[model samples]
Target chain A: MENDDTEYPVRYIPASKVLQAKVPFLDVSPNIALKKANNVLEEMAKDYVNWVQEDIKRLESTYQDLCEDPKSKDAITALYRVSYAMKGQGGTFGYDLVTFILNNLCRYLEEREEFNEGQLELIELHIESVRMVITHELTGKGGEMGKQVIMGLKQMINKKG
Target chain B: MSAKMLDLSNINILIIDENANMRIIVKQILRALDAHTTKEASGGAEAFTTLKTFNADIILTTWMMSPINGVEFTKMLRTSSDSPNPMVPVIMLSGHTEARYISEARDSGVTEFMAIPISPKSLYLRIAEVVLRPRQFVQTNDFFGPDRHRHDNEKYRGELRRQEDKEKQQDEMELTDAHNSLLKPD
Candidate 1:
């Protein structure tokens, strides 16, 4: 392909000095800074439990909305949005099982413009599993129960495929 | 994990996300970093409104959002006359790890990309990159954002290639050779 760079005149503006002036370069040790930051994250994790509870409720309601009217894009989007939000937060607080379950659901939703009966069922099952995870304070992989839940979800997805 | 310590005490950041939980988590982390100020917005449109007075040195936005997504918001910020600062660095936070999604975000003028469940260390490193080693902004007929070429491609001859950049690279290489020779007398 022939390159025509003349169409747009390019100019480069060096931006480092300007940004450096605003963002201070500290002498503080990284280990100490990270420790403080992690402490803050840990403090925030306390809220995550309650937050995920509300999120599960939101997921359950979204599922209900989809069930009542499977053709509604709004419900589907809401379902997807909630799942995606949960996936991003769960890992920070040791709720990796929630993230693992929802990651699959998010992918499924991403590929779908519309839902089918089995699709809705799959989504419902995911929502239920996450609800279980949250309700039981099931963090990390959720141990044996988590493994079983993940395996079951995978089997359902494979069956659909 | 990085060695550099940042004094975030003077930096003001704007965070835009549709998820409340995300906003809470990010704001908490930013505060923990001692960011001088942070203004939160639920989505891109609200972020635009907040930008009118926020004086944000950096923007952290989620890739997917309602009302206006991060890509659209970035394009407008880079081009819009009303944008408070056209050249402000934007670090896009995302859950979507698809290649296409990342490419779209980059093309739309995001300065950096981070897949979320953001840890303090990862977030700080990104902040440090933008501040300590900022890329030059490039303006043209179509795009007005950071220079997309993060490193020089010496093999390809292009109309826009700078001779100065080639010379700079050669000088650095020679300097490295000299330093290596000094370190090893053999």
Candidate 2:
């Protein structure tokens, strides 16, 4: 195994010096041509919906197993992986509501030391919120209702902790 | 030259993400930047195989991929004798912004870290940062990757400024000595 003290024979140039000396300005023009990119993203998102629904179903079943056997690390890890993927992809595909819910869910899971009834309920609520987001096609406009759901979930998590 | 004038048409980028949708999003963004020759890998294991033939100029990968995660892949790319180009720059993508995760990616040999929900501007900035202002690679017994420190802006003043300056000067002198020795008539 490699340790921190291992040394190699190379000198590094700092990014700051290179930026100052070589490239002072980074100019990126907004590509007007790619403005229609959103339409393409929407189409791809439509296809992703089916996959995401299937993932949710799997998560729901996993949650049930967790409730039955709370000590199952595999169930928690499986739930986390699916939620983590959704957390990363939802906003990119224009499903910001899903992203919002999943991001919080992932955070909660990360902070979890043990799975309890309260935690399970919160997870269930989060899963249901995701379902609602998908079924309603809640993109960026999940506004008030979405905010309330997130707020309620947060309160529940906080109260339990 | 400004980023606008910089032509990425000649640059070949390899994007490694588990999600097909992510690959599509990244490809579109790179296309907008005028990078036409882009390749995609479903996961890290496939990325290693693709690199054998793709000869990619830069690699953009996600933090979490099945079979082989980004950190493990980066370690292999940096140290494995079989690596096609061990020094090829790597940029890690992820939604997790926690300091621990960022620090982990840095230690694992990633050249850059980009957060998810990436905007065009942010993506362009990261690309420009890597290409225009490349960091020097460091090779340690345990690590072979870009230097961790990135900022050189004059506006910022921190407590470690003087110490960092001294370390940098010492490093430069050592490098000069080594170079001079190489040129000596022995």
Candidate 3:
């Protein structure tokens, strides 16, 4: 159980390195290419951060309501859609971490009919993992948030205690 | 699960393009066809990440984009083995009229293509064709998952028949062994 408050799970992939490895814009002017590339990187980070913010707000207001109700299928469906939305965009923009987290989120939500309290807790942990990545990446939080999220999820998912 | 137009209410479509006006126009077309859910991605990377996270039923992207072009994005997606709904039809919309470019798009796993300035009627019909086309090939794990969910009820029936054949063979072997013992006639 290494869920220390000091350690976060967010990992950073440098934008320059990502551009070199993943996308190389050819036939476009250098300034235009860099501008386009940077805009994409910035927008993806911004959009993801905003999406998590909305999710957090929704959870705060409706968490108990959804958890207690059996007919909250719409709420569950919305959550799955959010994760699936991330799945489509994350890998293309070089945010593999977000892509991976959302994918796990999708799998968890897909099995919602069979989800137990423990599995629900893991979903929360996965959300935390996403928040951790977004907070650090967006604010340049000097890496604290990432460690907290990473360690929290590791504690939840790691069974070899 | 009904094949009728009203039954697909749960489907969310992702439309990728750099043009805001184009996104809105396409959304309107989809909505006209009873598609209520739509998400927009403005660039290849954003579109890529969105596709990775979203459980969208269809993806309509333009070939010309800044940063990561549509061709490159499509190529990258085709390489991923863990992509959910790998068989999800991707229809590329391009303004390019060159035959060379069209074939290139086809070669890159683009299920269908349409010229830009696409009319509402054409868009609707193209979408219907893509969604309703008969499944002829093995949508194996060559895509992300088994083509079990997206396949029509008829395909599932065929799979069930294969399973039944295996079960019947097992039963016949047991019966044959019993008959052989009886024939020994001790």
lDDT of each: 0.78, 0.71, 0.54
Top candidate, metric TM-score: 1
DockQ of each: 0.41, 0.20, 0.01
Residue B89's lDDT in candidate 2: 77
lDDT of 2 by residue, B51-165 (tens): 9899887899988777789989998998899988777778888887777888888898888788887655456556666766577677655677887764445344243455567
TM-score of chain B of each: 0.78, 0.79, 0.66
Where is the poorest 10-residue window by lDDT in model 2 chain A?
A17-26
Q: What DockQ does candidate 2 have relative to the true complex?
A: 0.20
Q: What tens-digit string does per-residue lDDT give for candidate 2 at A1-161?
A: 12253344444533334233433322443343234444555666777778788778877987787788877877777787778777777887778888888888888777765687877888898898889888877777477776776677778778864
For model 3, residues B1-186, the per-residue Cα lDDT tens digits are 111222224566789886554565566556655567889998877876787678766678887666776766665655556555455567787655356666676556565667654544345445544544412222222332112122346575466657777767321112122222222312
Q: Could you give candidate 3's per-residue lDDT for residues A9-88 as a string of tens digits?
A: 32221111211222222232223322443454455445655655665554434444445653477667656645554443
Instruction: Give residue B49's lDDT in candidate 3 (0 to 100).
Output: 77
Please write out the lDDT profile of model 1 over residues B1-186, one tens digit for every residue.
224466788888999999888888888777777884888998877888899888888999997798788999999999898888888899999888666777788789898888777887667767876776577778777888887655433344233245546655322112122222222322
Alpha carbon lDDT at A145, candidate 2: 73
Report the Cα interface RMSD of each model, rounded to 1 decimal. Answer: 6.6, 12.2, 26.1
- Give the Å shift of residue B111 in candidate 1: 0.5
